[model samples]
Target: MRKNSIKNTRVNVEVQHELANLIREGIKDPRIHPMTSVTAVEVAPDLKTCRAYISVMGNEEAKNNTIVGLKSAEGYIRRQLAKNINLRNTPEIRFILDESIEYGVAMSKLIDEVTGKEEVQEDGENNQ
Candidate 1:
């Protein structure tokens, strides 16, 4: 099968959606923060494994704890997916902490700071 075949793409989207809902409404792990979200999922071409990218909105400790919780619940999650999804074999899922959101937020804040400084400099120059 092609790397980006239509079947693989559909599977990826469906798995991502189901997993997001499961995390949002079904999980009861305390280590998982309330702001955790399934940002993306990449399913293998062979459909044997899935890499779930999760974004946790919290400090480093909270993120680590959330990963731990997810890892521990991987089996249960897979079984739940098997029951909910129509896939032949529910792929083994691995949770990865995605920090892109945090990085983007940091970049935005930095940009804002730079712009504020530039505005201050412009005002000072105009008043001179």
Candidate 2:
């Protein structure tokens, strides 16, 4: 299949959704935080490997632990996924920590602070 074919896109989306559900309800590992979520999924064209992007809402330690826990449970998760979805081959799943959300939030806060300062300066000038 072509790398960017419609079939590949559909498979990627399906895998992402199923993986998120499995992590959310199937896995009971304590290391995986409740705030964990599947942010994205990239599957190889041959369906041999998949990179699952996960986001955790907590400190660095929690995020590391969540990735570790997911790595340990990769096999089981793949098996469950295969059973749920009729895929010819179950891809080797790799969990990755995604910090885009955190980065976006930080950027937004910085913008707000800058805009707030500009507003304050304008108010002062108006009052002067």
User: Best candidate per TM-score, number?
Assistant: 2
Summarize candidate 2's per-residue lDDT along 1-128 as a digit string, tens digits.
45478988899999999999999999999999999999999999889999999999999999999999999998899999999988889999989899999999999999999999999999999999
Instruction: State TM-scores per candidate.
Output: 0.93, 0.96
Best by lDDT: 2
Which residue pairs in model 1 clash with each other? none
lDDT of 1 by residue, 88-116 (tens): 77899989999998999999999999999
Q: Which window of ten consecutive residues has the lowest lDDT sum in model 2?
A: 1-10
Q: For each candidate, C-alpha RMSD in Å?
A: 1.7, 1.6
Q: Which stretches of candidate 1 lie above 4 Å from their native place?
A: 1-3
Clashing pairs in 2: none
For candidate 2, give the lDDT of residue 7. 84
